[model samples]
Target: MKITSAVVSVVLLVSAQNSFGQFPAEEVSRFAIKDFTFESGQAFPTAVVAYATRGRLNAAKSNAVLLPSPYAADLHGYDAFIGPGRALDPQRHFLILTGMFANGQSSSPSNTPAPHGGPDFPRVTIRDNVRAAHELVTQQLGITKMTAVVGYSMGAQQAYQWAVSYPDMVESIAVICGNAKQYPFGVIRLEGSIAALKADSAWNNGRYTQPPVKGLRAFAIHYAAWSQSPVSWPRDMLDSMSNQQVDQFLRSLEAPALGMDANNVLSQAETWKRHNIGDSPGYNGDVEAALRAIKARVLLMPCRSDLYFPVADAEYEATFLQNGELAVIESSAGHAAGGGADSQAIRFIDGKLKGMLQ
Candidate 1:
């Protein structure tokens, strides 16, 4: 399919299912980390990281680009930008799309066995996810340096961590609708969603025999309220939907959340909450110091109306980077704007990313 067509499909899927479509088997793969140690000092005997790749690694291995998945997404999260003639053209750059932990495909609370499964799973930070991806790139893929790290939402958080955690490894980074830290407002928003999920009697503190459908539905509603701009509700949804249609639309959002494992959802949310580049080793908890230490060319793309990661935060962050360019996405699609929610936003983001990659 053409790049534009693929992106349109991605937008539809994201709206309806909160996920991207599947890729061919040949493009998928997995890497295992032996005795992996997390930032929380918890160790797992064998931690598996699932990933998907496209294109060929050049002889010098200098053309590789890392695309980390966002919260609750798999490696296909960046499908909108992965086709030919797109910003991440596979023919030109070797794309490594890695899935985040607790995302079902990778090591997570729902998929693991007893002792470290469910609520007993150790706390994992954004740094831990980045560390595992670093291992996958260096040890598994045999790539020393990556040309760029492109990410959206939680993926963007990982991208920022990559530049800070290993300054010499990544040459450039595109942080789309994401922040270096999970600020106070974001923490409160996420906590509310978590609380809604736990309120279902079926949740049973994450030990339920069956999925907590009621709790998941409540969580989905809570997230939907904040995921889009208030303007979008009246302009895009209310104007287009009848009263019955609005109810159907809401049920669509709940469907995806209901299918997900509660513990898995909570796992990624916890990871998102603890994201702070300032907390990286040697930074002394100084956010500005960590941003200033980045050696990569940084591209900050925060949507103008994104509630999750506001443009104002990006503006402040750009001031600290050694070599950073703040390019605000002019859209009311909120956080989804950076994830190809609309054709115009997709085009705008693609243009910025292409320039940054070049």
Candidate 2:
């Protein structure tokens, strides 16, 4: 294992590429399988996983990269980082942005048919996502193997699963601001979100006719506080927003989120709550053994100030990888440090991805 830190800001020198990499088109394609069986022994008929592809596969079809969606994000969420000269570099490699199962686009609670729709949506794990994504790559895209699987946040969890689930299919992986397993403290935080939703009288047992506005707002407040570092509020946000505006901004996030199904959030939360690459086949829930079994060249990018998935988590995981490098994103932007959301962390993450692809 090797360790490195990126503390300098390269925003000026990185402008041209970042501007060029802003690919706008977000076309979606869907792949479906019948009788999709879940790890929970649950099954859903006609399970579909949606994906968006950019760039052309090389002559050998070996330049495929699988980009899984993070928590509450769709394929379009990555527009800032998926252009010609950007980190993903569509002009150079075939990019496959895989949507997480419960992310509204794919077979989610809001999209599925009756009975299995809404609260009835089946439970899906990280392994299940990797399994479906593997099928899409091999069967639909005709990609034998991936050059690398790249993801951030919850997407990073999927990338870790991809490396372990089908070690031979993935040559490398890039995981940003995520952990191999759901830390107990992390679960407690998510459970708070669930509790807030359940407390809403309008929830009506997940069958509410209207959005649980109050609950969603409460959840948004929770996210505003915990998703970011304590230092970010005074140092970063206050620099751009007034105290009153910051209060309104946090409240505003609830509206768009309300448009989404509560069950969808819960579905994603369940998967994230039990994220353990080791829990799958072969590893049998042994975390250390699963990390060792990953054959991919691993690029572990962790946010220095991320409360949920800190750099310390990456340092510990790197020790278990067969070939791993830990690149520290020194920022107080928290878990969002690497998704091209902020300048400092974006430059570091983009530079890292370029090196990984090369």
Candidate 3:
């Protein structure tokens, strides 16, 4: 009997699921650091950093680009930009995607040993994540330099920190939809997110026996609104969702996060709260000095529609970078627009990055 069209559709769906299931096996690679010490003066006996790499490292070791993963995103989160013909252009650039410290794939509270597993994970800073990236490049990969440091959102925050912290190590950077400093609004949103998690009585001071579903659901609702622009809401995200589907949509977004320890979420939030390039020694809390200290080529892509990190933030910071240029992404994707959400954004960013790579 000939196969029915319905059967063919079912087969295709199963094929997609199988491919998704194999992602971890194909992409994950880890680097172990013995007796790691956080910038907070807290130390862990041993930690493993999760990462993924694409493209080929050149003979001179200069083709490598450090793409730091964003908040709550894994190493594979950058799949959208890494490929033969994508913006990252694996054909011409080696992409080293580093997972953020508390993001579970790395040495997160959820994955650490019993004693420091839940509420005991040390407070990690943006500087600490940059430190891990440095070690991953210098010690594990044996590279002294990188072609570019490309990042979005929290990853963009890392890109800024990397440029400021190690001026001589990077040749260029593309910081997208994020700022060099944690603005008051950024801190406020983070506080609200953490508060949502804590409001759940089951949080039990991060020692809960079960996940905090109620608080997490509330947190997800709050997060979903800020993730995209209100103007784009009717046409893009949640376009035709029924009242019931809206709840379903919110739950799916928060599901992955529900598996995470509340303390881990708070730890990363504190790091964000303290993010400021000026916090580095030379700047002494002066943001302008920190931006001025950057000597590498710079590409700043701020989204005009982004409420999280406003375009004005990048505009002001660009004036301070000696080699900086600002390219505003004119999409209504909000902060995500800079993450290459739409074709226009992808093209805009691809052009800028291609020029920088050249």
For each candidate, the alpha-carbon lDDT, in order, equals: 0.84, 0.77, 0.77
Task: Kindly list the per-residue Cα lDDT of model 2 for residues 51-145, writing each as its tens digit.
Answer: 88989989899889888988867775465577778878889989998888888788888789888988888888988998998888898888888
Q: What is the overall TM-score of model 3 with all chains considered together? A: 0.89
Scanning candidate 1 in windows of ten residues, the lowest lDDT window is 1-10
Error of 3 at 75 (Å): 0.9
Best of the candidates, TM-score: 1
* C-alpha RMSD by candidate, in order: 3.7, 6.5, 5.8
lDDT of 3 by residue, 1-358 (tens): 2233322322222222112113466678889898899877888888778888888899999899999977766665566566777669888888898888787678988789878788888888888899888998999999999889999888999999999889899999999888899988888988888898789999888887887777766665565567666665544434556767766654555554454556666667778887898888878899999999899888999888887889888999999999998999998767666654566877888888888888
C-alpha-based local distance difference test score of model 2: 0.77
The alpha-carbon root-mean-square deviation between model 2 and the true structure, to one decimal in Å, is 6.5
**Inter-residue clash pairs, candidate 1:** none
The Cα error of candidate 1 at residue 119, in Å, is 1.4
Cα deviation of 131 in candidate 1 (Å)?
Answer: 0.6
